[model samples]
Target: MPISTYQVKSFAFVVREGSISGAARRLGVSQSAVSQHISNLEATMGAQVLIRGRDGVALTPVGQDLFQLADEYASLDQRIEERLRGHAALDRGHLTIIANAPQPALSLIARYADGYPNVSIDFTLFDWSSAMQRLQERRVDIAVITEPAASRELYIRPITQSRYVCYARRDDDFAQRPVVHLRDVADRTLILPEPGSLTQRVVSKALADHGVVPRRLVTMTSFPVMKEAILEGVGVGLFLSASSVSERSLCEVAVPELDQVFTTCAVVPKHKLGLRVIKSFLDVLADSRA
Candidate 1:
């Protein structure tokens, strides 16, 4: 019998994740089922593909060869399925998108949800590093990030651009200023995103360059929490201009010294661009601004 796509997928997941259990968890299948798929694939191929040891599963020489074939096969499967869906005029599919910045993806997702009610989307909020790593590993179909470094391995399309802005309470002494300098807030407590976030890195570097440090520094993971703290007079917050939209109570101050502007992009593995769903979404994104 021909090896099923499920069997190949299980094998690929095992190779990608490095364990039967990891593959099972990723595929949402039982460990026994994953093992059975591997056993069947090995039998059909008449070669050992995986060696299970204390560390994890390692691909044999033959398995390494098969692994490459499996990646191509998986990519082909996605293309075929997308074509089939197109021919059937079925708008139903699952898209997994991991992003750090919520801008354009959130807007695009809203449009997609309304247009293709049958399609489901899995959007995960991840740090910048995890967002890039997952896209490189092909774990997520799409990634949205700010000012990502250039990479030939992936295809990146810019969605929008924004500049860094300072958020402070309306009644604060510096709130009415046209431009707020780092020195103005040097003595005040600062609220920012956690350490690994791109926004925090930009703000920190700008502060360090100016030799300024806040009286108190607070890092929070949730954007709403950071906004609430700023509104409640906890501390000043640095955010992208897009994040400050519709926020009437807080004052938005531009800092010319931190002249860095952020560009948000949608990144995908170049190999997976042939999928119709991905292509359609990219089209929507492109047309969105027009």
Candidate 2:
């Protein structure tokens, strides 16, 4: 028997949304209906495609293979619906976006929202590792990432470039210097983002290469927290230049060892580039760059 498009679409939605109930809501069907479709899909393929867990659904090896084709089909279907709807399609839609940094992602989203107010957006901030993992899993419609790994499956466009810098309270002696060596901050209490973040990775490599180590380390979950910690005299913070709202109490200091420029890019699954919402967002990105 031939596989059904509906079954494949249901499976794709489950992967994209991360849960069957979420897929059901998107499909305007009951959760049981989505489950039955997934079951039927597995039976037809003669292999289990998904593993359900408390967190959400994960694709099995077979499911991963099937999803590429399924997602393309789903995207095409969406494109067709949008084309049939004409200009009205732009009036409302949904997009899922993830990012590692705040500047470009949040700014781009703000611009997109201004132009398409009715289009709902779900935006989340993630560390580099989690953001890349979600991008590879095809779970998000778009990701704005820093120094994204090259992949044929992804379509990437560079949005902006920046280098890492150290953040310190304005009154701190280090802030008075035009530039600080990695060694200078090594002896101070260093505040860094979570382990898998790009800032942590770059700082770790530079420290190892220069044979420097901080006297104490404080790990922060995000840029805002790191900034707050720095202001509170907890420690000096490391992050990309202009990653957060600048405060008069804080100053950015250049670290020549960490000066390697990093490019932040807008990324999307190549197969999904044609989807209306994704394309529309990319258009907004282009407008911003212009």
- Regions of model 2 farther than 4 Å from truth: none
- State the lDDT of candidate 2 residue by residue for 6-47, as single tens digits: 898999999999999999988789999999999999999899
**lDDT at position 179, candidate 1:** 94
List TM-score per model, in order.
0.80, 0.93
How would you encode candidate 1's per-residue C-alpha lDDT over 1-290 as one tens digit per residue?
A: 79988999899878766689977976779999999999999999899999999999877999877776686677778688667666344366667787775666788888877777776787877767767766755667778888776788689999888888888889987688899888877898988888778878888888998999899999987456788898898888888877534677888889888777688898987877887777877877887867
**Considering every candidate listed, which one attains the maximal lDDT?**
2
Write down the lDDT of every candidate, Cα atoms only: 0.80, 0.90
Off by over 4 Å in 1: 1-4, 13-32, 38-72, 85-88
Cα-lDDT of candidate 1: 0.80
Error of 2 at 57 (Å): 1.6
Kindly report which residue pairs in candidate 2 clash with one another: none
Find the candidate with the highest TM-score and give its number.
Answer: 2
Task: Report the alpha-carbon TM-score of model 1 versus the true structure.
Answer: 0.80
